[model samples]
Target: MNGVVQNDAWREEYNTLKEQYTELKRLKEEVKKLEKSCFTSSQKQLKKLSTIKKQLSKGTSGQEVTAKEVTEVEESLKKIRETLPQPNNLFLRSIVGSINVTIPNSEDKLVYKERYENFKRNVTIVICILSLLAIWIRGYTRLPEFILQFVSAWFYLALTVREQILIRNGSKISTWWVLHHYFSIAIAGIFLIWPEGECYRNFQMQFLYFTLTISGIMYLQFIYQKGQLYKLRTLGRAHQMDFVQDAGMRSRSMGDLYFLVPFLLYTYVFQLANSYRLYNMYYMQECQTLWQVPILGVLFFIVALGNTWTLALVLVRKYNS
Candidate 1:
């Protein structure tokens, strides 16, 4: 008798999920027609998107969902996701990412989201660890700054390729984030051409420390994000790729922002310190008899300001929401 009752309850929930899916599919069509007015009707479209998100996030009510329903939900959502404005660094994706020497675009094939994210995390760990090691043990190798430049460029290229893959695979990291890697690559190139001198000796060791700090932070973030993604995968809402991992909770970008506050705050402080040192160098040049402004340092200062502002926005949105 208990088994029969449980079966009946599952059947009822299954029926409801099917109805919700159908309604979401219908809204998807409406969204397509209104795509031209999407900017104008931003609020309405946001609400509609939220509704679709909720439908997808619905979990098993202690009942086994059929494979057929699962496929339908996945297909329906992916189709809509394809319609989202593709945010990416066009030049990097179009030109740089396809350079024959980089990793092949295996990501073009439909891969499991969690598996793909894990791959990205692995790549991050491998590249960052290698770069940090090269910096720390530069004595034995007697490596030149150009060696670090080459390594930095190589890693940033990998980053560019990875961001392209993520964008194609429905990750929500913005085009700005993708472009950041490009700037990093460009900076590494600048570092390659920068002549070694007394000024560089003053800057080199500090920069190496900065590199280690950033790399360490990235590794920690990877561990946290990977665990979070695993939880989302277990919960069956891993399909909501955009909001998972970053947020400890589902459908809460604000929660992700809050969760990252500590990390982002550290980032802000480091960037601020870096920018201050750069500004001091630049000011000294102004007061000196020679053209001594640190061009790369000034550029880093500018980037630091932008990053700090971006973090502030994330925090403000988190609290307001």
Candidate 2:
């Protein structure tokens, strides 16, 4: 009898659990339906708000849609967007072929962004160390320089992808920084493929030394700007997604200007100097026949101009704000 009773008890417990599981499954479906409904509703609202904005921009007035109403609706739309998930930007869509990069969980998003920043810093350090070794070994057109070029190309490619991910996750990284990496990739590729000859030998040390110098500058920027970002975040003055840039590309206080601005200007000047040297080398009998010289010179000139213009705009905005 006791064995029969135990069997009956187990059967009853199993039935209870089965019922609970069925209810949980039903609830999950219901939740999914509600989420879809909300998304559809938000889409409709966004369309309506967009129409209202267009009307307002055209100086059209309506009883139901005042300027204040449109503004409020726009704000509501922005908040709704914050709650909803988004996919990668158009640039990433074109290149990386569009997978959602949004991190839904707040804690997970923060952790991922922190990891991204650390990855950049670690790569910078690795490149700096390798550059130093290359310089010390004095292998301008040999294995060391080749290795550095390969590593740099890979680093820039990876960095560009990660920055895209970060941008998708709500980081306010500038377009110029994104383009800068693309340019760097191209330059690195040119360096990787350029034939080793008198022209290569002439420009090799200058290029390596410039890489080391910039790496050092970037390291210092990372150290100082990381602290600045943390402080700004703590004070609720900056977004959590913000990361350090070698040029302090974001609008910030003038305090770091005294320390970082000179270095940034020096970097631009160095690029220009490289460009001029390349220009001069391209005319020399030894380098004149090389196709890489003029191309590299033009690229360096453009990069320098872009960097200076971007920094100037950033500083101007900072001052105005």
Candidate 3:
């Protein structure tokens, strides 16, 4: 009798689960139908607007009526788009194959954004630690130096993908910030493949020191900038999606400016110095044949110039605002 009772209970639970599954399937179909309907309606609205535009161009009189109609159509179209799912950009579409990257829920988006920021902070710590190890080892054959480059390359690649996702979710990351990572990836790759010899030995310690210094500065910037962002968000001056890692200077105060500018300038100056050293090294009798020297010099110089210019623009914008 107990066995029979257990079998009946199991059957009832299975039936309940089956009913819930059926309801979920029906709800999914309804959502798909709603999406299709919205898209079709938007297409129709666009066609209607195009027709009106052509009619206006053809000199159909009633100019005020035409203008009013155009305004109404555009407003309606905007509303329609607001209701529709945002289409993914080419970069994101290529990787994720049409899956939406936009996190519609505010809390979920905040969690993802914060996670990315935390990841960068942790990676910065790792880079700093490895850089110090590389400096301590003090040799071209050291594993820490090579591992640091590899880690940097991987980190930047990950950053580029994450930033693209963040942008889809309404984060205002600039174009240069994304491109900067690509440049860093290339720089790191160059460092990795750079043959171990006199040329490598010449720059290895300097590179490690530079990495350590920059990582420290970056970690500091992350802390201060994150605090500034929180303050700005509280005061309604900054968006929640705005982050420390973003290239823009949205929430930056004069205090941050004073704190950040000199360090950043020094960082760029170091890059320029590195570029100059690489340039001089290229013409030297021992290093002339190495292809990585000139390419890296050019890359470093480009990044330095871009960064300086971007910083200048931000300062100007901040002052003006």
Candidate 4:
């Protein structure tokens, strides 16, 4: 009876051990399946993350990405990381950290710098031509306007070339010099194309229109240059000499004042010329019905005086200042 009892006890113990072993095997299988799924999910998440990182690095604007989309991607990556084994978790963490900083290519920077220099040079040439035209109209017309125009144009062109060389050598062209050059060219062009006589009156009107258009454009440019100068001066006052060293900034300030003087002169001349032509036409046609000759004369005189006074004041101030 005792032996039977002992055998029964052994059997019960073996059954208990068997049950525990079966449970442990089942748990191991489940853990293996979970690990496999985690690995697959992690791989997918890594690939998606890599793609997103590439897009970001390619200069994608923040405006194009939505908060919701970023959150979703981040959440997915987080879930994947949580399931990943310790070794892979470290790798994913490394990838996430590295994605934020981008390495710039020196070659691309060089290319952009070259393109900017080319643009500046072209602007300088246009300015030079405009200067020649202005000077020619101002009183150099006897030397065969075209020849004088050509020589003056070439002279400024040479100056621009020298300025460019100076710039290349690390010295900058003065803004005043550039403005002077461009204003002279523009004035020259206007004078060269000014209309005279009935035969060319219409042409003159057209040219006047063109000059007005150019004046508007130049006015805007002048304003921009002035703003730049103001900022540079402010910076200089702040002890930011680095701003002063910028060729464009230094040139723009002087250019602004230089251009402003000529611009005022050109405006006066344009108004005077247009008014005279209009009066002459009315007189010839006997259609002076609107304005009396005296009134027109007074208006013209006032405008001319005001313009001359303005120019004189400007010069005086410039010299004194």
Query: What's the CA RMSD for each of the models?
Result: 16.5, 4.8, 3.9, 26.8
lDDT of candidate 4 over 87-170, digit per residue (tens): 322323343432311112335433434454444445544544554464446343333444444544454544444343333223
lDDT score for candidate 4 against the true structure = 0.49
TM-score of each: 0.58, 0.82, 0.83, 0.27
State the lDDT at 245 in candidate 2.
Answer: 68
What's model 4's lDDT at 164?
38
lDDT of 2 at 198: 83
Alpha-carbon lDDT, every model:
0.59, 0.81, 0.83, 0.49
Worst 10 residues of 1 by lDDT: 100-109
Model 3 CA deviation exceeding 4 Å by range: 1-5, 36-87, 246-248
The residue ranges of model 1 lying beyond 4 angstroms of the native Cα positions read: 1-89, 92-145, 232-259, 283-293
Clashing pairs in 3: none
* Residue-level error in angstroms, candidate 1, position 259: 5.9
CA displacement after TM-score superposition, residue 174 of candidate 2 (Å): 1.4
Q: For candidate 2, lDDT tens digit of each residue in 47-151?
A: 877777887788774646687877887777665555454555676777677655656566877898888889889989988998999889874337888888999
Q: What is the model-wide C-alpha lDDT for candidate 1?
A: 0.59
What lDDT tens digits, residue by residue, belong to model 3 across residues 206-251?
Answer: 8888899889999988887787777778889887877675422675
RMSD (CA, Å), candidate 2 to true, equals: 4.8
Candidate topping lDDT: 3
Model 4 spans with C-alpha error above 4 angstroms: 1-211, 214-218, 232-256, 292-301
Q: Rank the candidates by TM-score, best first.
A: 3, 2, 1, 4
